[model samples]
Target: MILHIDMDAFYASIEQRDHPEYRGKPVIVGGGNGRGVVSAASYEAREYGVHSAMPGRRAGQLCPHGIFVKGRHSHYAAVGRQVREIFSRYTPLVQPLSLDEAFLDVSGTLRLFGDAETIGRRIKAEIAEELELPASVGVAPRKFIAKIASDIDKPNGFVVVREDEIHSFLDPLPVERVWGVGKVGARRLHQLGFRTIADIRRYDESLLKSKLGAWGAHLWRLANGIDEREVIPDRNAKQISHERTFSEDQSDFEFLHSVVCFLCEQTAMRLRRHGRKAKSVGLKYRREDFRTFSKSKVLETPTDETAVIIRVATELLATMRQTEPRPVRLIGVSLSALVGADAPTQMSLFDDPGYVQAERRVDRVMDQLADRLGDSRIYRAGSHDWRKRPRE
Candidate 1:
């Protein structure tokens, strides 16, 4: 069986745990700054609709009395490590989805650790007793269903779905519970009269495919509990991204474009360090009111060059701005569909070989300078000191 373990309000809960006075009160980590974005919200804060990735200003508006604490990313990472250590005691087949969530396949460990439910209960008890953190666990025969079962009830929840009980358990739930069915997809599903998983299950898969394409067929199978994905241990990084939240909302396109350029450089640097080249570039834009938009483009050829990444990301940013034209709370750049930098790839017929060689030489020199003088001391001229620019 598979067990999905998700920590409850991880960052905010850590703050509350350490600061006894914060208990039972609204706590918003990465809040209090007008330009910042919330990293996590405690259960108390969540009552007012505060959540991770929300603008700090908006979180304050929702929970006026919320306790705002700056995030300690390194410390949280340490805590996450401790949690993983606990998971390691029970099963080596643990696959981490994030610091706060993981999947463990215990089909082989049943002889030593009891059934999946018992092992899950034990793990939850250990986290509470040792770390004073709450977790929700879901036990199922499949991965996606296990994830859904874990989230059905949260903030100290546990649910198990037997092989025989899968359909009855999944039928009544909204289609949104299926992975990849985000707000836009949910709306499309609703438009097609798919309100529940059962609705998707009853509909013809080919018809669903006709409406939603390949994704529709995928969702249809998930609705019928046919996920074939295994709990892969130590999954490689599938994406790399960096983002910056301003001290205040920003509306200046020139300034925003510069920030995107800087972020793209940072992302590209990391991509090169990982010995990978990206086949896709993406932009993440969060508005002052907290609405977020994302756009991405697949490259004609994979690249780890900052120039190519910045150009694509900037184009996407321009596209997003044309539609929204609003003050941005946060902006980010991401690289994905990564392949080894040394991997065989199709060379562009129109490639300027001299330009490519020169760009690589510049990148190598810049990387060396960054290593010796620190990233803060070295930056491309086009990406000015936007972080130090006074908020408007």
Candidate 2:
């Protein structure tokens, strides 16, 4: 059996938990500026048609008096760790879908825990007691059904689909509820007169394949409640990247370089924390009109050193420079081609300069402090002015 746990309005809930005054009111968490988009919306805000990815200005138009708060990812991560700990008590086979959702294989522990439904209830209860947040749980014989069941009753709710009820429960659901069906996929399904999972199941497999290619065949199987995916554990990431959308388009080279340096340091710190090294560094920039460009270089040696990553990133950025300056709307840095610490290494004859080494040491100190005190606790000297000035 598989159990899917999904936290309800995770970010907004955290805000409400910390600030008692925000509870049961419309709240949106994201950029406070009028141009920013909503990162997460409370249930009250959702009732007003506000949701994640909606423009902050549009969200405000939907719920004029809605409270808005900037996201604190470090706080959310702390809560996520607490939730993971609670999940560990139930089964070690927990596979996190995100910081707020995960799938657990409880088939092996059924004898000890009684059944999937019982396990789901216990997990939900523990999360509520420990984190003081609401969660919804869905349990079924397969991952797809389990995920769907969990969404049926949300916000401190639990639902279980017995082996025999899988087909009946899934048949009536809209095609959008299927695993692979997004807006475009659903629209195609709708055009084919397949509005529900049962409709898709009624079509011939060959017809589905002919119409949608491999994806159609896969959707047919999913509609019939047949998911062969295993609940694999220890899914290590292949790359780590961070990007920030500026509140206003910027053309300042010094400011852009600072943001890139900070991102490089952040990615390098994450790689080192995972005991991994990267052989490639990449940079991405988006113009004011949203045209994006990226460049990457394969390093001669794999490294998790911040100074090396930042140097390579700076070099990559230089190649994209043009005579006509354009304002940047977003900036990003990423490291890829990862290898474990136990892997073999080749030494470089030319070592980094003293100043580069010093910068790396400073990055290490900042990383430790950020990990303990939080990301906002430390900032690059000039990056502070990128945002608004404080009243005090």
Model 1, position 237: C-alpha lDDT score: 62
Please list the residue runs of candidate 1 whose C-alpha ends up more than 4 Å from where it truly belongs after superposition: 235-392
Clashing pairs in 2: none
The C-alpha TM-scores of every prediction are 0.69, 0.70
Q: Positional deviation of 76 in candidate 1, in angstroms?
A: 0.6
Which pairs of residues clash in candidate 1, taking residues 3 or more apart in a chain or in different chains?
Answer: 35-247
RMSD of 1: 7.8
Candidate 1: deviation at residue 212, Å? 1.4
**Could you list the CA RMSD of all candidates, in the order they appear?**
7.8, 7.4
- Deviation from native of the Cα of residue 34 in model 2, angstroms: 1.8
lDDT of 2 by residue, 212-304 (tens): 776678888998888998776533666778877665678878778777877876788777767888999999886654456888999887887
lDDT of 2 at 60: 76
- The all-Cα superposition gives candidate 2 an RMSD in Å to the true structure of 7.4
Cα lDDT of model 1 by residue, 1-392, tens digit: 99999999998999999999999999998747665667789999999999987877888888899999977766787799999999999988888876799999998889998999999999999999999999999999999999999999997999999999999999999999997665556766788798999999999999978766666788899999999998877435678888886656789998999999889888898888768988999998776544568899998878998878888898998899999898987788989898889866565888788887888888898877665443545678768756444332
